[model samples]
Target: MKTAGRQTDAIVLGAGIVGVSIALHLQERGRRVLLVDRGEPGAETSHGNAGLIERASVVPYAFPRGLSTLAAFASNRSIAVRYRPATLLRMAPWLARYWWNSAPGRLDRLGQAILPLIERCLDEHRQWTKAAGTESLMRDEGWIELYRSRRGLQQAVKAAAELAAYRLAYDVLDEAALQAREPGLLAGIVAGAVHWRDPATVSDPGAVTRAYAALFTARGGELRHADAAGLQQDSTGWRLSAGGEDWRAPEAVVALGPWSNDLCEPLGYRFPLGFKRGYHMHYAAAADTAPRHPLCDVEAGFVLTPMARGIRLTTGIELAARDAPSDSWQLDQAERQPLAVPEGFSLRWLHRDGAAPGSASLLTDALATLDWPAGEGSLYLWAACEHAAFRQIRAAARQYLRPEIDA
Candidate 1:
């Protein structure tokens, strides 16, 4: 490999939001930094998510415990969860660990551990958005989770109490109140709604990521197209090939997200990393009608959020190998009843709006608003939870770079 014969303070692998954010922070601290990625920033998993910078997500997703819920998932009757048998077999050990970690006490501890970082999401993202000049992409309208039955509503309310303990604000809206706030919603369809008022949404998740990367470059940091898999260590520190030249850095960070294991495994570091694949499709709303805010169809197991392109419908998790072929069965089932759209909203509208029917947008817009006194959507499934671990990564990097600085 051709060597550039240059050294920097640090090199960050991956160009997703996590990597970009870390690079930006390091550069802000006066570290000479180089960010390497195989493709354009945020073009992978970071691009395709319900775009909520969830400040209220104090809890991580726990594995299902109820027999009925487990049965629905196993029988493939649930739209919210799907799994390939072979993938499940391969993931059994990781799944077992996840299950054990999801025990009430363990999950609660995890929540407490990550709560500080979740609380900082808004402020941290605000700083980046401001510097990146993407402030207009953000919205403070929060989200809503609608329950179809009294039991579901009650359970949600009980859960809200736990969330409230963390100072996350929410409002409970009964059916009439819910309809009043979101007239486009089918009247009387939902028993109640929980409006989370603390979080913010983004109009275009990918654009925000790109904007942050732009800030990184403008701040004198480098964004080089390179495969992180070629990273190597040397007596001086670390080196990697990118853009046909080899570069060196005293330190390196692996923020590859789902592919983080590729480099870590070869380096003999093993972490029980897992992923839940999801899908999303956008559609045009009928004339003069659109969801005011993001809404989670709790029973249906999907989300509908108003977006700049159109209305985005995001599906729930699918347990599969990282490289498994894409599956649209969940999307097909979710299309049966597209919530947050008018009665006549259909595939025709999507075709008329320039997006072909069933064409998926690799990136999704965050949340919308409602006409009611208060309305919001579910916080689950958005990409913000990953920030929890990102905080730890940042802390470790800071400590390593500034050994003279006190914690």
Candidate 2:
């Protein structure tokens, strides 16, 4: 362990994609940023996603309205969603708020509000990929949402009209067209698919985050291992303990994502943050039989994405406490149909207050405001900075120096 008196213009806690992006953007704006995380950047939720930049996600996911859908979820018979009764009980309030926000009118307003941000996701990622020289890790070919039944296809076609209204590009591929595009798909497994052509996919989402962190450090920003619990505010500003040293900054941004509440709740700032835990596992593909694009089994609740590691099968959502013990039943259920024999497995949990898009947009707007009053306490910059755009600038000064350490 080492100790030293260090100071920075802004300290960013949590080095996930959002945190790293915030740190990078602040650095570009000439702020000496210190990015702190308990583990390596992107090693958490950022690394485990389906890897789509989600340009077509103009609309956020709404709570199920149909009786059948609700029944299926309640009975745990739906592959699309699963919940533990105890977890649901604990999350009732947050879930109620989420349900209210998912009303047709509110959902529509949320979609329109998030559309501009969705449109720029690809371009923003492109800039980072180009600068970090991680272009090879990215592909612009988009993704597919495969339907197993005619009803599913019809519902998707109807949704396509709404997507077109937002000027989002997509194509409804019939069974034959789907086969033509992805011959490696299990024969007769899907009726058709909606090809979302605007989003970009990454081979390794975590690696991209690490690359951005590398670029941040290369440009003189600081990346350190720190406990966000130590965050404090006083007449001067913010102070945190990391690597046995006291780090002080006049301004600080908390980008801890799922664990953000740990620090913010202590500081008297509480948002109705919730969690939707998920899981993922990789499998080997037979020779020349890997998927060409990411494929979501719309009704089945799992996605098979062609990743650098292998075919990654990711689960939908599991409502549980953040620290709840892992359950592999979703993975077991998904594997029963033989998507692929799992060679490796991992579990992940996603934390969202309401809808991802809406939550992220609100969070980003809060973070971009720099003149937050110190008397109010340390700023808890939750998930808002994840997709927020920043003026790119490279910093030149290094008053504090530390060797690059990997976690």
- The estimated TM-scores of all candidates read 0.86, 0.85
Q: Where in model 2 is the C-alpha error above 4 Å?
A: 1-4, 338-378, 384-407
lDDT accuracy of residue 39 in candidate 1: 96
Write one digit per residue (lDDT tens) for candidate 1, span 1-407: 65467778878887876678778888988999899999998787666567877677778667788888888889975679888898889878877776777788877776665555566777777777788898998888999998988999999999899665687888999988887778877765678899998877777777988988998999898999998889876667777887776788767776776676677678655445666777777777764677888888898898877767777777888877767677878877887764545566646434221211111111011010001111121100112223233222233233334321101
**Once superposed on the true structure, which residue ranges of model 1 sit more than 4 Å away at CA?**
1-4, 338-340, 349-407
RMSD score of candidate 1 (Å): 9.1
Tens digit of per-residue lDDT, candidate 2, span 1-407: 56546988888888877778878877876889889999998886777667777777666667778898888888985556777898889878877877877888877776665555566667777887899999999998988999888999999999888666677778899878987888776566777889988877888888988999999999999888978888898777888878777888887877776677778788776655677777777766764566888988888888888778777777778777767777777777887754422222222212221212111222211222222245733363544322232211111011112111111
